[model samples]
Every structure is written in C-alpha cells, then in structure tokens.
Target: MDCGKRHGTKYFTVSSAENFKECMETCAAIVPCHSVDYQARTKKCYLGSHHNNPLIIASSFDSAHSVGCAGACGGGGCCKDARKDDVQEPAPLPDTSCGNAGFEFAFFPNDITYLGPNDGNFNPVVMKRTQPYYKGTTTRIGVTDAHIIYGQTPQNWEFVAVNHRGYLYAHQDGEYSFTAPIADNLSLLWLGPNAYSGYTRANANLEAAYTPVDSAPLEYKATLVKGKYYPIRFSWDNSGGAGYYELKIKAPDGTTIVDGTTTVSPYLVKFGCREAYGARQYAPWGEEN
Candidate 1:
C-alpha cells in the first residue's frame, strides 16, 4: 500500500514527535495503528485505526499535516468497513505497448561523492576516478518509464545517484536526438560503431552550478543503425530536495523512441562497493562496461 499525506478518519493521539519518520515508526510498532498524521509545525502525531475514515474532514490546508498509511493494508481489508460509502475507484493504467523497450537501472545510495563540492569539476576523468560506496540495484519496476522516483531521507544528507544502461534501437540509420531534464548533476555517454570523442561527441555533462529552471534539455545527436543495440549510459545525481529525473529521445524517423511515458524493464544485479583505480567498476553492472 502507498502512504500519502491526506485527511482521514480521526483517531486517538498515540504520541507527539517532531520528526515524521519517528511518528511513522511509532505507528508501525503499534498493532492496531493503521495510519498516522504528522504535523510538521507543532510536531504532533495522530494515530488512526481505520485507513479511510470519512468522518475526519480537512481542518486546514497546510503542509504541516502529513498523513501516511502503512503498506500492511495491501489486502484491501485494513479499512474496508470505512470505505463503503461513495468511494471512487482509481483509473486503470494505460496500455504501454506503443513503443515498449527495456532498460536497466541501478541505484547507489550516498555513494556518488563526485557530486560534492570537493570534486569541483565533472568530466570523464573525474567520473572514472570516483568510486561508489554502497552499490545496489533498484528493485523498483518501470524505472525507465516516465515517472518520478520519490526521494528518500538520507542518512548523513539528502542525495541519490542512479546509473542507467540500455541498448537503444534505431529503426533507420540517421541522426537521433537524446534529451533529459536538467538535474543537480547529469551525465550521458553513448558508445557505438561511429565513434565520436572529445567534448564534441554525442554526450553531455551538466554540473551542479546549473539550475534546472534556468537550464535547457541536454541534447545529443548520433547516427545509429537499424535494429542495432548500442551501448548507452546515463548517470544522475540529486544532492538534495526533490529526487526526480526524466529522459526522452527523438529518433531520426521523427518518432519518439523513448518518450517521457516509456516504461522499461529494470533489474538489481548486486550490492557492494568497488575500488576506484583497481578496475573499471561501472555501478551495479560491475566491469561489464
């Protein structure tokens, strides 16, 4: 089940805390607590037994109040009694077979030290020098699809890095444009038969000093072959704030090969760290790059 910040049926106050995670942890510890309301301003936490309580109305519109439901209500029986009156069902997901293609994504938590100020410069030299601390594949499905990966609370600070690798298929041999939304840090590299090098290649390296609002889409032009799988890698770093990123491609045939709504198959390969200079360790895929 998904937990969201919204109004629900009222219940007794179990505890009061300043942190939202602490309140959610408290609710998880309780056997009867199914939901929790955390007020960011006053640091107050309210526990609820029912998932969908129609009685609790929205008192005020403020970011302080955050209500979350536990994942244990997956069976749809946690609050069945409270949802019998005029409940609207969610719309079904659209068919994703329009231009389906698969891609792999690996998430490294707090491992991208190159994104820090200490690194200063972002280049292939810097990228090859950095080593990942904690390496793990993201089990989240539809990672390649057009959707935002919600940010998580970091241990030391708020940050996340993702490495995306996949084979881009081209219908005809021509110029293909690849683009992705600007983030705190974004880097893309494509290696194919027609090799292009230096800073003029079909690649991009956007640094931390650039803001997303004032930035334009990172564009790269490449000539690909038909029905060929090219080796492509995209790395993203989010230091803090919202954790989200997007990638899109415009094919030579004037068709959107990888649109903002495209979904790709993702898998988790392994977990652990790799040495910086020992071998070329590429994120979760190891030395396969």
Candidate 2:
C-alpha cells in the first residue's frame, strides 16, 4: 500500500486496541483521524491523525481495507473510559535474574463517591491517591493475599484491585500454561509484549465466560525459550464481593504451581531496575548485573 502516497499533517499514533471493534472506537475518539488501518496478523491497531492525508503508515503487508473508524461504542461513551488507556511515554522494565525474588504490587482504590461511576479501574480522578500496597514478596499467589494488602479481616477484601507486575522467568524452555481455576468477583492476566505499555482490559486473558468454575481448567499456553524473560502482569479485583483467586500454572515438564496457602513455588520473581525488560534476553545467572 502507498502509505505516503497521500501526504498531509501526520499526528501521533498508538497500538493499544486488541480487537477490531476497539481499534475502530479509538480512532473515532480522535477528532482529526481520517481513517484507520488494522492488521489482523499483529492483533494491534495503528491509528493516528492523517489530517486527511498520509505519511508512510507502517510495515508492508499483504492486504488492507480502507474504512471509517466509526464503531459500536460511540465517541462520547468511549471517551469516558479514561481507565482504558492513557497517552504517556512507556517506562522500561528492568532486567531479571535468578537472584531476584518476589513481585511488586500496586493498589488503585476506586472508592471515591464523587468519582461518578465505577469504571472498574482507578481513573485519573483517584490516580493521585494510588499507593504501594505491598513491598515484600510472597511464595504463593494465595487467595488470602488480598486480605494482607487491604488489612481487612478474612473473606472481606473489597473495594480494591490488586495488581502484580513482574517478569515470568522461563528457567527451562517449554510450553508455559496458565489458568485461573477460580475467582471471586473478577480476575485477569497478561503476558508477552502487549503486557507492557499497550495493556488494557480489552487485551486481558483467562476469564470464566467460556468455562465453568473448577470444572475444567482451561489453560492459556505460550511457548517460551529458556533463560529469556517475558513481561508478565495479572490483576485480581474484588470491589463487589468477598475475594478469592488462585492462579495455577503448569511448567513444561508438567510440574504444576498452584497459588494456595500451603503451596510455594519458586517461579515468580522481581528485577531491581524499572528499565527495558521487554528486550527478550536470557537470564545472566551467576553473572554480574
């Protein structure tokens, strides 16, 4: 496609939309966006201002369809979902090693009454009050962890979402499978490149709509190389009811890691720096940082 054929004012672009409909709505929100180009192969939306023109859109591809970005959400409704995505420079995820231990947790409490509606996220209205809920690392992703973060009694972790971000260290190459066996109100997870800057609720995986609770463990698997690191993130929300969540994992060799109170698997770990951990490199074990 002659991306630069039609020249005009080129504004900024973003690749956050994970679905066809989302890609459409994102462009509709921008006043100057003339059209949108979605790549099914990449599962990402590339949309920016053409000022009714174009400038070298992106990489070469087989086929493309020129269409308007008007979709279901309607511009006004999509604009209210500020918690959906934000325009900001992406922060780098630092390197990781076997020496590292535990995950870093952050809390976004969306409980302010005047904040209008509960968009299921900590929007800008309450963004200033965000805090570090937990500092230490835990061996298991047990259901009880919610209470520890909220300082509430058992079976009463409410009005908060626990976000854990770190690297999924693949010590040995194999198919890494993940599943949410059971969850109270809500649970979501993300892995690989999109888990970083382009993350949104639309891109999250492993929910319970397709499978029943504890009946069949529907697993989402990713073939990973040993010694390499993949950006990882999983969130557990319990604003509507008492909370309970268990993220079970299966290593390549079929060794399962379940996040129950009595079990502790040495899988999840945190790297010290907050730089570019998304570079896809092997672990520098026994090597200096």
Candidate 3:
C-alpha cells in the first residue's frame, strides 16, 4: 500500500487488479476518503480498479517529454501547499454608555444556564429546584427580596433584566426592589427564594396581592410565617379543577425548597429558619409534595 498526500490523509495506489479492488474496499471503510487520482499513462490504479487498463509506453505519449522533464530533476511532480491559515479572532465590541456592572432578582434557572467561559467575570450563582406549593396543578417559582445573595438562599447566581436599549434594568415592582447596575445585555438571573414568600401578586394598579394569579378565580390564599423558621401555608376559599398547588422556595444561599403538586386543603406550610437555610427541596411535577 502506498500512502498519498503527505500531511494529507491516506489514499491507496493500486498496482494490480486484485490490489485495486482491495484498495477501493479499504478506502470505502474509512470515514472520509479523499478522491482517487488515476494515472492514465501508467495504467496503474489509485483508490479503484485500474487493472486491464491499457499501458502507455514512452512512444505512445505526447506529454512523455514534459513528464520526463519533471522527473529528471528528481523532484517528481509539483507539490501544493497543505497548510491552512489560523482561525480569525472576533471583532472588538463597541464602547457602551452603560457601565460593566448590573443586577436583577428573578426566578432561578433563567434562559441561559452555562455562562460560556465567563463564569468568573459574571459570578453566577447556581439555582436549584424545590417543592411546588399545591397538589395537582398550581406550581410556580417565587422570588423574595429578603434573602441575601450569599445567604442560605443566597443569590450566588446573578441575572438581570434588560430594556429596549439592550442595557440592564432593575426589576422594579411595588415592595419588590433591588439595587443592581446595568451593562451590556441583561445576562444575569435572580431566582425567587420561596414560591409563596418570594413574589406577591398585584392588582391592575400593581398593588401587592398575596395570592398568585392562578389562585385568583379559585380564591386561594397562601399565608407565610416569617421569623427564625419561615413556613408558608396555603388554602383555597374556592376550589378549582386544580387538585393542588406547587410551591418552590430558595434560601439566601441558593438552597432550594420545592413542594410539588399537593391536594388543596386547610393549609400548605414550608419552614425556613433564616431564609439562608431550611427551605424545602425541589420535587418533580405530579409527585406528592
């Protein structure tokens, strides 16, 4: 077997009929086989059946002299450059009127999970899944303002919202506000600490409504016990077809507490001592909380 294309992949140059067939089969087995170059003058095979081909004697070839001229120098035939240029670098970004820092508080596990290779510069905190508040269908993530970024429900992972200008904007709602600056795009995420305690529903005017929107028509009220151990309880004045409500809670330290769908009843309670610890663990959907 003769290897063709130095620094190039392997290719077969068949000298006989049987060898040509073998070479063709061998090349086919390879993942990416280069094209076969057959020498009509020599009647030799390369990557295919070259047997029974008419052999050309020096007398039969008009280009024989030119071919001979090249061989005379002992350099064989002309060689082509095989090296490729390096990959191009990305263009520099334009200077932004916005600074490099920003902040936002939101539900954990936002759209972009992996920070590419910029985790260090971004200082992303990991968000965990936890229990849902109700039993059958009322499941949601809650974001609370009281929890610290590094506390038990710490906001180690950060994300921010952006305005039409593509700069970061603070998530502003009545009674729910945090201080964080804007940079380029809002690539940070702020997850809710507890499903019930994190975010509160609002009226049309954005007034604080303790119950979630889904709980509205159903008349569900979720009560939270705030102290050393915070436990959120839930009950429905009117029951919807939904059998349960799902609740998820995050501690200041990024620990997650989740209650999957549970039966609507007198109360649904989750305990947390410092908003840093004692949050419920996340659970899968349809499972008992």
lDDT of each: 0.44, 0.50, 0.24
lDDT for 205 (candidate 1): 36
> Residue 4 deviation, candidate 2, in Å?
40
Per-residue CA lDDT of model 2 for 181-206, tens digit only, reads 76655567778765544556677665
User: Tens-digit lDDT track for model 3 on 136-169?
Assistant: 2222222232132212232222332110001111
**Model 2 stretches astray by more than 4 angstroms:** 1-99, 112-129, 133-135, 144-156, 209-213, 262-264, 272-289
lDDT of 1 by residue, 11-83 (tens): 6674676555666667777777766665555667777776553232222211112234434334542322233
Give the runs in model 1 whose Cα sits over 4 Å from its true position.
1-101, 111-157, 193-215, 264-284
TM-score, structure 2 vs. true: 0.50
TM value for model 1? 0.42
Best by lDDT: 2
- TM-scores, all candidates, are 0.42, 0.50, 0.15
lDDT for 256 (candidate 3): 33
lDDT of 3 at 216: 29
